[model samples]
Target: MAEQTITERIGSADQVLGVSRREIMEQMIDFYKLGDGDGMRQMFEAYKNWEVRYRDGKRTIDETIELAKDNFDCVARVADGYIDSGDTTVGMVRAVQLPKSTSGPISEFYRKTIDYQPFDPNRN
Candidate 1:
């Protein structure tokens, strides 16, 4: 089978979870923007793995999303250092640097989810 596109994956996830893709994507972008590359990468991998398990009937969609959210929270904790310092601009820059630190699934997730646009620190 051909690899699924992000849109397809989002559609599948939304259908199963009964949520809008944009809502999920927006939350993901928020998490991605706030998270360091390593944490974001780990979160992406965890989500992907959970997605597979969900497909295989080994996980529930709620469990999968909760896992994703938990991973995202981990990254948020990491971002707290920057946020607490009142240097969120620098923090966002650091978060965007995550893609540079890794390749493969995380990078692909970042690229596709962000639509290949450069990270905008000003985006709220």
Candidate 2:
């Protein structure tokens, strides 16, 4: 079987950066897990740059832990600073309902209904 282009599956968009928006986001927890300052800094940078293009995933351990109230206050800042920086759409979000699957792994998949218009700070 053949795979569909991002648009063919997602419908419409100016660009399809990658499967996931950012690597730091996925690794944010790792930074906390290892108490790695460097990883934390990198995650912070990635968080600040919310619209950074898709990044390749790196080797990381799977774990979850609790953060201090102060730390959560700090990390909660991630929810801010997102804005549409350009006219073109940068990403998409899949609906809750799953469409029929194509051949291959199902862990990472795009949908056929939407072109995610997320916050981009570069719009002028």
Candidate 3:
């Protein structure tokens, strides 16, 4: 069997995970640019594992995507040198020792603040 390219692997994962293939490919490309092949592999593995574990369950695809997102976020943070020391009274505090700015699509997603709009049944 021939080896699959990264895009092919990501496409397969997107089908299994019920996520947008474009999103997965973008993330994989970001990791590749950072030279973090292991992180990209981990993200893909997490998706596969989630599919197997929840294949016959009542869990929704959104839940699985959230789990995958968490894994991706942790890997990205770690790659930027944010080590998880332990939980604090406030919450889990990651020790940010690296001087690099957390500027990326994933970082932006995590940092975005939600603005709630009033319910308008007629809008949609």
Return the top candidate by TM-score: 3
lDDT of 2 by residue, 9-36 (tens): 2232223524333332233334444544
> Mind giving the per-residue lDDT tens digits that candidate 3 earns over 8-124?
554465335555444454565476567665666565665646564655556576666555555454444443332122222111123134322433443333223111122224454
- Candidate 1 residues lying further than 4 Å off, grouped into runs, are 1-20, 56-124
Q: In model 1, where is the ten-residue run with the lowest total lDDT?
A: 99-108
Q: Of the candidates shown, which would achieve the greatest lDDT relative to the real structure?
A: 1
lDDT of 1 at 14: 34
Per-model TM against the reference: 0.27, 0.23, 0.34
For model 1, residues 37-103, the per-residue Cα lDDT tens digits are: 5544443564555465556456677666555544433334334425445464554455456543333
Check candidate 1 and list the clashing pairs.
37-98
Q: Distance from true position, residue 30, model 2, in Å? A: 1.5
| C-alpha lDDT (0 to 100) for residue 6 of candidate 1 | 41
Ranking by lDDT, best first? 1, 3, 2
- Better model by TM-score: candidate 2 vs candidate 3: 3
Off by over 4 Å in 2: 1-25, 50-124
Q: For model 2, what is the error of residue 107's alpha carbon versus the real structure, in angstroms, after optimal superposition?
A: 25
Task: State the lDDT at 67 in candidate 3.
Answer: 54
| Model 3: per-residue Cα lDDT at residue 121 | 42
Q: Model 2 clash pairs?
A: 83-120, 84-120, 85-120, 85-121, 85-122, 85-123, 86-123, 92-116
Q: Which of candidates 1 and 3 reaches a greater lDDT?
A: 1
